[model samples]
Structure formats: structure tokens, C-alpha cells
Target: MSILPELERRFRRALAPVEEDPDPLLAMIRRSQDPKFGDYQANFAMALGKKLGRDPRQLAAEVAGRLSVDGFCQPPEVAGPGFINLRVRDDWIVDQLTAAIGDERLGVPAAAEPKTYVVDFSAPNVAKPMHVGHIRSTSIGDALARTLRFAGHRVVTDNHIGDWGTQFGMIIYGYRNFCDGEAYGQNPVGELSRLYQLVRRLIDYHAGKTRLAPLAEKLAGLESRLAEMHAEAAAEGKTGDKRVKKAIHRQQKDIDEAREELGELRAKLEAVEQDPELSKLAAEHPRIGQSVLGETSRLHAGDEENRRLWREFLPPCLAALGATYKRLGVAFDHTLGESFYHQRLRPIVEELIAAGIARESDGAVGIFFEGQDAPMLIRKKDGAFLYATTDLATLRYRVEAWQPDAILYVVDFRQSLHFENLFAAARRMGYERLELKHVSFGTVLGEDGRPFKTREGDAVGLESLLDEAVARARKIVEENDDAKPGGAELSPSQRARIAETVGIAALKYADLSQNRDSDYVFSYDKMLAMNGNTATYMQYAYARVRSIFAKGGVDAEALRASRPPIFLNTPAERDLALELLRFGEAVDYCLKDYRPNQLTSYLFELANCYSTFFENCPVLKAETPELRQSRLVLCDLTARTIQKGLGLLGIDVVEKM
Candidate 1:
């Protein structure tokens, strides 16, 4: 029933003895760009003509004459520049839809040669809360995993939690020295964030002191120079002297900017030193980073007290993260932390050394690539292992434990070089047979084209962001309900559930509908709209389809059981049928590129086609019973396709939105 494969079959039969290789003209067959041309176009004749030094149009004519697609499609026509166009007959379109109507998978075929995939994504630090930065990787990775699973691939989802790291050191130190026990008992993450911030502020204060003193001195000198210039200009009647006045004005502006910066820097430093505990520690030790690192080193060495503190800090942080993931409907097959691979780091480094892939560079084990400046460090000079070392161990463990065919790391685009070295190192470690890929994504920018954040300029927390989205969506839904008939009658529970569904869908679809490699500005107002490519648009489209069935009193189950013949009478009806039938093709195309946007684009186009059909061809008031039944079937199929497509993106469609 898939058009591409059937056309390929006809093409293979047409050019059986013409070419020596079977797939020589393979990518030439594709959907037509213009509707004036037929449904599918084959540009094989042009390439074949180039090979044989024959006229392309003449070759196309011969190929068109020999094409054997009579019943499925009308006569094949050779167009300009050796493009052969083919259009399917209406009868064949209905036959395909009838056959596809009974299948749960909607006529999409599963992979004939399925491969196993281990997708690693949504990696949040153990005690650090999830924020807006985590959305792209988590949402995109989950969608790709679902697509692959639905396509019959064995997928293992892993959330590589950052449990053992320098951040934990800061937390342990802050809790012991500066924590408010009552505050932490009530809001663990909030109190923990405050503690972490205090430690970080202390570090920044000491580090910025040297720069701040110089800046303050420079600002004072600039202000003194500006005052002298202004006095000289005023004494010289500089109001009429444009050059002198301009110079004085510029000097004053520069002085003002410098003063502002110096003031802010000093204020921040003073605030950090205002904390009594940190001030006392600053006076006593003068260097807190070293102490934090000492605690980190002990934790690495398995200190009992640090371990207990870490255990205490992890639960509340995880609960906060779990709440966010639950709202987004994201789950993981494995939740392995970096601490799980701590025991294997040394052995991994030793194996690399024995295999001649790793060498000691200033007491640190490193892997160097030819023509590269820096060697990726596996072991630090102080006998500490880095993330590179743990990544290597994780790769080996995944391969040996699961024997996966492919492993995808959904990480930030900033770590391109890190993944490059990691993959190269994994290959050197004898994983050449495995397919390793780093699916890097860009940052979510705000309306101002910077990283998304609150109006207060703080990074948006993931849960807070979702909660805001739901609240905003609920207000819109309520507004709609009040403005329309029977909308005010919706109970509070129903409105609440609908708002949650719409809001989460809006957030997820807004992220998924964009090209993954490009930086997209996140705008809640634009993404949650009832029109365009937003999730609300698609949701409303599905609801409209359902409403059609309801108004017509059409029994979808009986219709499916009866297997009625679908007759495409008008241009809109045929276009809709074509779009619906290409659902399988769209899924295949999306799976191949690992781009959910492709599927989104397909569903959006399908919705557009449905809209056109609804406007032009009346379903309940059709000219004949056959036409009405056919349009009803089309509506049902389109709704099902939208539901299945959105579900793959981990989005839900409401029945009565």
C-alpha cells in the first residue's frame, strides 16, 4: 500500500534489462513538487542518459512507454528534462485506504532488519534542579526513542545522572557549614540551591577581587578626567564648540558606564562577604575552593560522612526532577549515575595503556589524536579521573552488557568536540563495529534571542516553566469557554485536566516542531496559539474531526467492520486521501533522519488538507451515500493518524478541546 515501494516495483519491472545494477536509479523516485505534474516523479532517465550519453528527454520517453503501472495509476507521462510523472487513479487510492483501515499500525511496515539502540539523554546533575536547558535533549531524545520503538527497534533509554561530581562537593560542604536545617526541611531544593549559591558566590568573590580593584581604580580616573574635561569645556564656551562638547559628552558616558560596572561588582562582593559563616571562613582560610576540592577528593575516595550527606541530598533533588518528568510524560529504562562507573575508571585507563592507545603526559593518562593540539585527558595528574574516562567506561559497559548496534548521545551542541574525541577513543578501544552518534541540539533562546529565562533574568526552572504554561493555557481555555455556548458548563476538574494536556502538549510540540540543529526562540504566546503549527492547532484539528463523526452519528466501529468503499470525488477529497495514505511514508522518512519535525510537518499538512476538504466537500450533506461514507472514513482515518503521530511525540490530543 506504500506508494514509494509500489512505484519502485513498477520502475524495477520497467527498467529490468536496461541497467546492469539494480539500485542505480534509487533516489530518483520521489514525491512531486508541483501538483501540475503527477503525484510522483522519477528523474532516473536523466541520470541514465548522462551515463549512456543519450538525450535525456528521449530516454524518458522510452522509459515512460515501458512503464507498467496501468490499474494503480493513469498513463505515465514524460515531462521536461526527462522527468516522468505518475498519478494514481481514485479507485486505487480507495482500495489502499480500505486495506489500511483495518490495520492498527495504519499500513506502516516495521523494519525488516531491526537494530538495537541505547539512547542516553536528559542528564541532570544529582543535586542540581532541572531547568530550561534540559528540555531540548530530554524531549527530543524521548521522541526519537518512541519513534524507533514504534518502528520495531529495540531501544534502551538511559538517564546518565550526574551523582558524583564537584557540585556534590559544594553541597556537602555548604550543608555542614552554612545550611539552615528548618529551611532545608521545608524546601530541600530551594535551600540546597541557596547553599550552593553561597559557596559559588564566595568562590566568585575571591576570584573577582583582583579584577574589581583595578576596575574601581580605572573608573575613578575616568570620572576625574571627565570632570576636568567638562570644566575646561565650560570655561572655553564649549557649548558652541561641537568637537570639544562631543568629546566631553563621550567621556562622561564612558565614566558613567565604568562607575555602574564597578558599583555592581563591589555590591556583589560585599553581599557574599556579608554572610557571617562565609565571612568567618574567608577570614580564617582565605581559600574555599581548595577546601571544597578536598571534600570532593574525599568523596571520590569513598568517605563515609560525605556519602551519607550525598544520600540525604539526592532524594529531594530527585523528587523535584521526577515531578517535572512526570508532567512531561518522560521515563527512562535505566537511571545510572556516574558513580556507578567509578570503580571501572582505573582498569579502563590501564587497558588503554596496555593497548597502546593511552599514554602518560605529565603524570596524566591521555589519548592523543594525530594533527590535534590537545589530548583528551582520561586521568588527571593528581590521579583523578575526568568525564572522558567515565564516558569510555560507560561505552564499554553498554556494549558488553547489551550488545547494542547503535548508541546515541543526546547532548548539548557545545560539547561537539568532546563527543568527537569520545567517539574516536571508543573506536580505538575496539568498538568499531558499533554505531555511535552524538545528536547535538542548540539552546532555547528567549524572545530577545538569548537563553530562555524569567523576566528577572534567572534561568527558568523546568517545573516552573510547565506550571506557567498550564496556567496560561487554562486561562485561554476558560476564556474560550465563557465566550462560546456551553463552555461555561465545563466543570473545574474537566477544565483543569484539559488545561494540563494542552499546556504540556504546547510545550513539547513547540520544541519538537523546530529543526533540532537550529537555535529557536521560545515564545509561549506564539506556541500555544489555536492556529498555525502549534500543538493546540493540531489538537483542535483532531477535535474537529471527532466532532464531525459525532454530528453525523457515524459509527466508526461499524464503519471499520463493514469495510466500505471510499470514493474520492473532488480535488480536495483526493488530496486528503493522498495525505492520509502517505502516513506510513512520513513515519519512515522521520525514522530515517531521526527528526520529529518531519512527522510534525506531515501531520500539519494532513490537517491542512482535511481543512480544505471540510470547507469544500460536505460530509453529512454529500451528493450521495457513497460520498458521505467515504468522507466520514477519511475524517476517522485522519483523526487516528493525528492521534498516533502526536502520541509518538509524547503529546496528547483532547476529545473536546
Candidate 2:
């Protein structure tokens, strides 16, 4: 067992008999800011003074006199501000460190009452390549899973993929109208690309005139009036009238409001820009745009043509998504998409209706959650199930099948409202047994601090970015290591494989090391840097330690071949040992906070300590034989710590630079 539980028990027992509030005493152990003050400190005397009606120092002395701690920590000493400074005996720290070294879990005990948690993350929609937007979810989700599993919890990671959506309607239309049979037959992703292009072309072909006839004329009049106002404001600016500035401001607002209606106008116009044929059709036959959009909508609303196209493209899209997941080392426990919840949607609606929790609003079935001004739409006015219906159905399934203690949704921040409503509605319907959490993170930004995009104006593909990283990693590996023993050079494929591992690890670690809730600027140079908190720095530390041991011919099988007693005489040695022993505590904290960056921060510090220890205490330069062997053991353990620590973060460390 860890020292925390023992300390906690003793603390509670000490406070149990006292008639005053125990929360202060309970918080004292955690109040200690640093190790220099003592391993733990309690500032409860100050808290008790106001409550117990006594002087803070006198109260602390009274508590100290009454409290008893043995076989764990020394007698608590009353300090300034009635602080009780508690220090574990040196023998205790050594014993704990020794126990940790011998134990596989490093003296960290599994949860006394283990929980089964379901973490849903990295859900990219079917038919679209995984993009920069998906990186945070996948990376953060994996790190969370790793941290939780290490903490002895049963973790179930679900990839709640967006496989069912309106995009399929346009995809179907494109596949049927403009698909090249031979091209698709050869390459599925390429074929889907052509289909996506075709659908986009059709969208452009119909965009300019998709607005209602009356609305279009109104918009035209508004635009004309807006242009006239702008021109008038420009001409009036010459007179410098104060009212002209106010009129200009008011006119600008009106113009902006009008331009927003042209959102549909702009999207269609963009599509037209990409396809000459679509552009010509948009100009020559405005009604064709309306007819095409109607058809696309009809298909999305369960049109037979759209359904057929969705069926054809879905499997291929899933296949493509699977390939990306494999490349990124992410997987799911199940493959349940929106279509999987189709059967349950009707039952859910029935259950909600029976409970009187749902009502028909504007021809749509919805549930208006308490405290929420807006209602959650479960079904469209046309009696078709919406995303809300499927999500609710999925929630029910997870509850029935897995019965998770907590359900974590690692979705985009924009979908916070949807999840909030769904969670509230679930609670309202009496699913209080399950705790729901939203692990929402910000979007991935480009160098310019905007959303990442490709030159082709599409979301940057995961495959392309990963491939580039791997390629760069390979170049670095080759530059560092050329000869493969006996004057033979490393093969291209071998170099490529190593590079791939390093590159991907660098990319994944960069994201995992940052706070998941904040947007991070993705850059290769920063992530792959040989210094700082980057993966390369950690890997280099691991490699340096490994190199020292390898030169001494010390292998894993020979770790126990020699027994070297740990000597913590030097300050550097004591510091390194203390840092190494704190690994388990770091892991525990990460699990508690659901933050891998906590662990990352610890790992970085541990590596830094090891570096300083090696610099100050020269292992190879020791005078005595036993001293040399003892230092080697320390080196070996340090290497192992680096390996295990990085491994826990899902990052691989190479033995050489």
C-alpha cells in the first residue's frame, strides 16, 4: 500500500475524537507546498482557532499533544501560523523506496474499490479522412486510457464515430452522377475522393439559386441598398459630419446581417469557383441549382437514391477510417455508429413519450431540459430521427450493456451544448447511477492561429501529416546512426521504420504534454526539438542512460546479476532517488485529475534530475569497485524509469539518439 492511505487513516483517527470540524485536519496533509518544509504539513490549527474559539498556536499545541503517529511519521511539530510540520523518518523513506523498487507497481496499490469507466473519443465521421481536428481527441483519449489503466481501473475506450450524417446525401448524388467506374474500382479512397469532388461540383452547380425565389429578390435588394449606402458613406466622409460616422456604423451592421443570408450564397459560389461546368450551369440555369438541392435534401430525408448511395459509400468510408486508426495506434472496443442506434431510436421515443418527458414542438419531438432555454430535438418535423435520438439511444445501450460507473465524452467544445442537454435529460429520466463527463478540448490551430486546412481547402488529412512526421524522423535517425556493425550501413526500410516510430511519438507526445482543454499550435520544429519538454528530450535521456549500461555489458537479464546497495550520501544521489520514488505518486495524480500533462510534467522533472545526478555524481569515475557497481545499478534503474515513464505516456524511447 502507498503511504497516502496510511497517512489518511491516521489523520482521520487523530481528528475523530476532537469535537471540532475535521476538514481542516484532513486538508493539512495536502497543504504542504514543497518537500523542503517536510514530506507533509497541516495548517489546521489556524482553521480550528476560529471554529474552536482558541489561539491558533495554542490549538495546534493541544492537537499535537493529543495526536499520536507511529511506524509512519515522526511526532508533529507546531510551527508558525499554527502549522504542524510532519516529516517521515529517513528510514521510512528508504524503506518505501526499497519496497517500490522491488514491487512491479512501484509500491503503488490498485484502487481498493476499482471502477469500470467508459471513455468515448477519437470519433471521426465515416467517408472523410481523419484531420487535424481529430488529433486532440485521439491523443488525449489514449493518454487518459493509459493513465487510468495504470491506476488499476477497468477502462473501456469507445470511438463514437460520426458515420451517419447529411453529408452522405451529397456523396450519394455525386457517386451516381459523376463517379468514374474504373478509377473507383482501382482505389477506394481515391474513388471516394472523386465521388466527394463530384458531389461538391453538384453542390456548386446548385448553390447560387438554392435560396427561395422571394428571399433571393429580397437579398438582391438588400445588397443593392447596402452597396448604395457604402458609396454614400464614402462620399459623405468628405464632409466629416459626426452623424455620418454613426450612420456608417448602423449601415455596416445592416450590411453584415444581410451578408450572413448570403452564407448559402458564398458556399455555393465557392463550389462554383472549383468547377467550370457547375459555374456555367449556375449562371445559365438557376432552377437547376434549386432542383439539385431539392434532390439532395430528398435523398438525405430517406430518399431511395440517397439511401442506396449511403449504403455503398459507408463500408468503404469505415475501411478508410480504420486504416487511419491503425496508423495512429488507436482502436475501439466496439463499432457502433449512428446507424447502430437506429432500432433503439423508436423505443427511446416511446419511453420518453410514456414518461411525459418529451413533447411535440413545431412538428418535432423534443425534450426541454430543466434550466435549458432551448429544447433538444430528437426527431425532425418530417418524422425522421435526428442525431439527438441516436445519441440518447447510444447512452441507453452503454448503460444496459457495459453499465459504466462514468461515461466520458471526448468531443469538440462546439458540441458542449448537445452533451449538456443529453446528460441532463438522462439524469432527469433517472440514470443518476451513471456519472457523465464531457472532456471537451479546443480545435487544432495552424501557424497563423486559425483552423488547420490543406492547400486543396479541405481539412488536413491525418495520413498526410503522419507520413510527413515519420519521413522527418527517418532522416534524423539516419543522420545519427549510419554503420550497422561490420561497416555495413543501415537499410532504407529500417531507417524508415525507426523514423516512423520517433516521428509519431514526437507528434503524439507534443499534444499529450499540453493541457487538453487548451488549443495548441502544432509545429514540427517545436515537437521534434532535442531540448525542452518534447518527446525527443525524453527519448534522448532514455538513450543516454541506455548507452552507459550497454557499454558496461549490463543487460536486463543481468540486472540482478550483481547486488549493489544504494548509497544516498551525495545530494544529487538523494535527489535522483527521491524523484524516482515519486513516479507512482505522479501516476496517481494524473488519474485523479484526468490529466496526462501532470504525468508528463513529472517525467520531464525526473529526467532533469537524473541528468543533474549523472553530471554531479560520476558513476564511471568512482574510486572503489563497490561504488562503481552501485552507481551502475542506479544508472540502470534510472534508465528503466525513463523507459517505463515514457511507455506509460504511450511514447517509445530508443536506446540511441
**What is the number of backbone collisions in each predicted candidate, taken in the order shown?**
0, 2
TM-score, cand. 2 vs. native: 0.85
Can you write out model 1's per-residue Cα lDDT over 67-105, one digit (the tens) per residue?
A: 888789999898889999999888888888998889898
Candidate 1 error regions (>4 Å): 22-24, 210-286, 454-457, 485-489
Determine the C-alpha RMSD for candidate 1 after optimal superposition of all C-alphas.
5.9
lDDT of every predicted structure (CA atoms) = 0.86, 0.74
Q: Evaluated with TM-score, which candidate comes out highest?
A: 1
Error of 2 at 275 (Å): 4.5
| Residue pairs with clashing backbones, model 2 | 206-289, 474-499
Superposed Cα deviation of residue 598, candidate 2 (Å):
1.4
Instruction: Give the Å shift of residue 396 in candidate 2.
Output: 0.3
lDDT of model 1 at residue 288? 71
